[model samples]
Target: MQTGISYCFLLGWLLCSCSETKSNHNQSIQDTAAVLLQQDSTSVFTTTALVEDTTVRFDMSEVPSEPDTKIKILEIGNFHNNEVWKGADNKQWYGLFQTTTGYYVKKTIVQVKTVYDALLDTKYVWSGKQVSVSDKDTCLLLITGISLPERNIDTVVMSQKTIWPSEKISFTVDSITYTLRATGKRQKISNEVSDYRLYISIIKDGVEKQQLLVVHDVFDDTMTVVMWVGDLDGDYKPDAIIDVSNHYNNHRPALFLSGEASEKEIMKKVAEFSQLGC
Candidate 1:
């Protein structure tokens, strides 16, 4: 027949060119598995939006307690290692940092655990270290949540308390007395023209509350002091941690919390952290 119909039309065009090259090699492996599943769902939606944009929370009725256990999570920073936190979950947490050098020393109780970061999924921090910290000698000041009758009050008040201006420093703690007074007016700063400010007042029971703290233009002795007082949010009352940094090579701590104070306010700074020395 014409050479067998040209060999069956060349074997039906070589079986339709091997079925269109095996359907383009299975559509290039399904378009490379749909671009690797859209890049693994955009890398898990950008690590769940970087763990919800660096969480910070802390407002569960501002620590009213006993709903599912308190401490709404604080975790400010400087504890190091990628710093991302939230899971205190089992409760009971606190770091505080800074182990020595001025304002009466002592505050290194860091064990830490609760990590699971596939990009910060669960966190609390610093575990497995049987205590041997040295960020060239520690500094961090917060991590939050601790109450239960505890009172190390940074070595239970060792020393450093010279906040004068009109002079009036006092402290009683558990029985509650805290008096503090340091009005202002101690100038120097050639041309920034200053009032400099300082304000303190505090009083309690008889109620006085003023609190401005410091403004500084610099010069003359420069030391705000008062470093530590008891009951940091356990709510037994009196809580403090001022450094105000009139400068001793700069420290600036500032943290007061009488359980978020407010009958009209006696103490309520909540938090502050700063440190620098070269």
Candidate 2:
């Protein structure tokens, strides 16, 4: 019986040792798996960091910067004929005569009434000539003078005092439609009369922003502003065309480049009237 008890005890101890060895093996396998998982996570993190660095170091030097602001000044002349006329009855009349020296002389005629045998005859007498003058000349003559219709100074002054209506302008850039309102304001330049300033308002993406553009009048009565969209710089992006004219005779073209910030900036003055290939 003692021998049988010893064998049973030995068998029980052997079984317990086997269970402990199995548990140790399982624990070792679990630790190895955990280590492998940590290695894999570290490798993934390193690979992700390298990919981020490569993305951040991408080259962007080829993209062009903002172009320079080009300013062009143009001088406009008058559009009119110059000549003088003398009637067969010795009466003088003002006419337009084209000459190489470019001078326009306006002659005045005086009328005298005489009665002969209950008949009244009116005779025209030629007076001295008066030449057109400029602001710089105390007395001068203009060769290419434009004669506008005589305007009443009082009426013009009254009209100037009245409020002018705003003009609506629209253009498309890159398939996006843009609308602007030109509000008129008077601005005085140096040694010149008060000019009309077109304060522009831009509407984009359902938001309204002001002062996106402004056009200064070169002449008080003959100034005009025109806007359109075109690819002026050959960049394929739609550039804005701001054309200022004086009675459609002198054209000043300005270009606003297209980019991310173009909607909020002003245009650059480009070509004068003479530079246009018309």
List the candidates' TM-scores in order: 0.25, 0.30
Q: lDDT for every model?
A: 0.51, 0.38
List, residue by residue over 1-278, the lDDT tens digit for candidate 1.
99999999999999999999999999999999999999999999988774434543222222122223233223232222222223332344454444454322232344334323233233432221012222334433443444434334432453447555555656566665556665555435532222455554455577666666556665344557666666554556766677777656556677776677677666766655444332
Give the residue spans of candidate 1 off by over 4 A. Answer: 1-93, 96-181, 188-231, 252-276
Task: After superposing candidate 2 on the true structure, give the runs of residues whose Cα lies further than 4 Å from its correct spot.
Answer: 1-165, 185-195, 199-201, 234-237, 245-250, 259-263, 270-278
Model 2 per-residue lDDT at 9: 100
**Model 2, C-alpha of 82: deviation from truth (Å):** 24
TM-score of 2: 0.30
Native RMSD of candidate 2 (Å): 32.1
Residue-wise lDDT of candidate 2 within 94-174, one digit each (tens)?
A: 222223433222432322221111121113222222122222212121111122122111100011211222545555555
**How many clashes in candidate 1?**
0
lDDT, residue 259, model 2: 36
